[model samples]
Target: MKQDNITAKREQEKRIVSLMIRTYCKGRHGTRQGLCPECQALQEYALLRADRCPFMEAKTFCSNCRVHCYKPAMRENIRAVMRYSGPRMMFSHPVLVIQHGIESIREKKRLEKENHEA
Candidate 1:
């Protein structure tokens, strides 16, 4: 993809992850729409990973990446946030959710094809 596309995708990923963390922290951590300290750290770490991702716009969903970049604890925290917020995304941010869903499916298929080829 073009550089512009990569930048756009990175920004989108940042936004999506930020929203998920914020929502999760607000409800479960009792922050009431704001992230608590732990969630704040997780969000920052997630954004850093997304920004530094080698595949950038070419990446599959982070869940499907071959190389796991996040540390175990942070990864689990993110997974929890995702599990809580993913379904809710459809209702809260339908456009972004749909786009990401489609992209995730496509990326999964692509990875499967590569695995088969290998």
Candidate 2:
């Protein structure tokens, strides 16, 4: 049961990150169809990280995660993608943005409580 939950969370993270990368690639790279080669590589790397995330059960999103699992260069690349894609997500994926915001807040509160307890 715990494994199932972790798998679901991982898949959801992958889906959201993939969407963000696709949006960034299309808007920035002017790719009319699927992701360009560069974005595709980034997407794959992001998904692999998500798959291996140790804090998947606790973290709501990569932005809220304290541990940086991504290598420096890939982390910078993902940051660029998020910066370009985040505001745009309001127009393209408002629901996801809202949900992510809510989840981040909840996760922050949960972590605070854990720290306070400890």
lDDT of each: 0.88, 0.89
lDDT of 2 by residue, 1-118 (tens): 3989989989988998999999899989999999999999999999989888889887777777789899999999999999999999999889999998898788889989989999
TM-scores of all predicted structures: 0.90, 0.88
Q: Mind giving the per-residue lDDT tens digits that candidate 1 earns over 14-49?
A: 988999998888778889756788999999999999
Q: After superposition, how far is residue 10 of candidate 1 from its true place, in Å?
A: 0.9
Clashes of 1: 0
In lDDT terms, which candidate is top? 2
Indicate which candidate wins on TM-score. 1
Off by over 4 Å in 2: 115-118
Q: How many angstroms is residue 111 displaced in model 2 relative to the true structure, after the best TM-score fit?
A: 3.3
Model 1 per-residue lDDT at 52: 95
